[model samples]
Target: MPVNLADQLKQQALAQGFAVAGVASTSAGGRMPLRTAALERWLAAGYQADMAWMNNPKRLAVQQLLPGVRSLLAVGLNYYVDQQQGVGVARIARYGWGRDYHRLIEQRLKRLGRWLELQQPDSRWRVCVDTAPLLDKAWAEEAGIGWIGKNGNLISQSHGSWLLLGHLLTTCELTPDAPAIPLCGSCNDCLPACPTGAIAEPFVVDSRRCIAFHSIENRDDTLPLPLHGWVAGCDLCQEVCPWNKHHAKASTDPELQPRNWILQSKPQELKEWDDNQWDEALRSSALRRIKPQMWRRNLGCL
Candidate 1:
């Protein structure tokens, strides 16, 4: 029985545990031009902070990276957990609460890519997650999975901005979905929610002043700003967004649920952790990026 390639691929993606999936065009215009131009302006402004890798030329050349590639299949998984850290504890972002998303998302993408090869033996596909040289959020939105919120995260109509994004570039030329439209309209709740004025303006997050950026990426002798109890990543903007506050559903994915170690640990405990303790807590976790000295540095900031 013949079936629509795009629909079948999306079904396979959902069956692979993705909450939402859609296809997007890799052709000129239709959001790609505007998205890349905005990125150029952002880079010119030095908004990427110490993350110099944003200058990767491949990021804007997804269309040319893979020969004959004509579409992207964007997928997102909801990672929201209702649990909140207690006072004096490390305020890790919900995205970093469980295991490493890179591994889990990569596994899912690989499985999807395998299914694609089975469908079309001659097809070529590229699986990408966090480290890929692509403007993932833009591609996700263009795929209709969600809209990019004023807070700089993809906001799904069903799952809000608490989504982990990944996508595949394929030569299959699947039918594209209508791009998601911005629905934040006049609502500025996420702006003032940022403690460090990181939301320099709507839709632009200056990483230099972002707590999550500083806590995870900055490695200077002393933190330049206040932490407000965050030792890993901050969640204030998402926590205050109306879409997340009112519409976000708690994810049931076991891999994304809050871990007991994170639930029980405090800042002081993290500061006092031995080498073995640190490794145990962060093993195979995205939080592993916060090395032992980084933990001490972050705790000292508080």
Candidate 2:
């Protein structure tokens, strides 16, 4: 398809509720320049902590996601909001404050894929959200959706760093987008804002110090004594970005809104609940990734 046609598809994505969208040629996939080398160095320093999955060599390269994939269609959804979690209440990552993004983005991608198939019935394509073993953040930057920030998150022009990314890859040829230019030329706010100094350097995050890793991926019973205060994903870096000043809080998706109880519950209140109660409370939220015991452990931090 022509480059104009690809741009048209991106317009359609915005109309369909995506906050940011772009396209990249998968045939060109490889380890992203500085970040790739940085990832290796971080892993070598034991910076990834115990999240061994992140160091998988295949995931570090995009071509490994799908053979014969020629073009990547990247989409980003804004999840930034003005509502702050109450103090004394453990903060859940804003993304997980609502419904699971994996299911939501997947459903939308399938719809987009269906439409693409109708446009080119013979083309082969694959939809990916966070579930795939691909360097999605690099693809997002290459697609012009956003630039990777010092905190290692995609920071959008319109949405700051609070966005979710999804994409589709097709065997068909399409005009690829020039990568988004980095906007954080001289900013060091995010790097200093981190409580754990996770943003060890510009565009590089030491997962060993990342609160999100401690809250979600750390399957162990005890959180590192340093990160016990975080209950879910952390947004400290995103919150401190200057670009976010002009950003509006995203409107609530019916599915993404937190339940009344979760928004209102005190840390002590949550501690009293058992597994079944936790399950019921988090039925519609992504917090289920951490079991009730984990929630209790996190709550204990307060």
Top candidate, metric TM-score: 1
**Each candidate's lDDT (Cα)?**
0.89, 0.77
Which ranges of candidate 2 are over 4 A from the true structure? 1-3, 29-33
Cα error, residue 299 of model 1, in Å, equals 0.9
Q: What is the TM-score of each candidate against the true structure?
A: 0.97, 0.92
Q: Candidate 2: lDDT of 280?
A: 84
For residue 278, give model 2's deviation from the true position in Å. Answer: 1.0
lDDT accuracy of residue 90 in candidate 1: 72
Per-residue lDDT for 9 in model 1?
92
Q: What's model 2's TM-score?
A: 0.92
For model 2, the local distance difference test gives 0.77
lDDT of 1 by residue, 1-302 (tens): 13499999999999988989999989887888999999999999999999999999999989666778888899998898777777667778888988799999999999999999898898999998979888999999999999998999999998889889999889888889999999999999999989899998999999999999999999887888998888899999999998987889887788888888688787777778887888887888999998888888888888
Instruction: List candidate 1 stretches off by more than 4 Å.
Output: 1-3
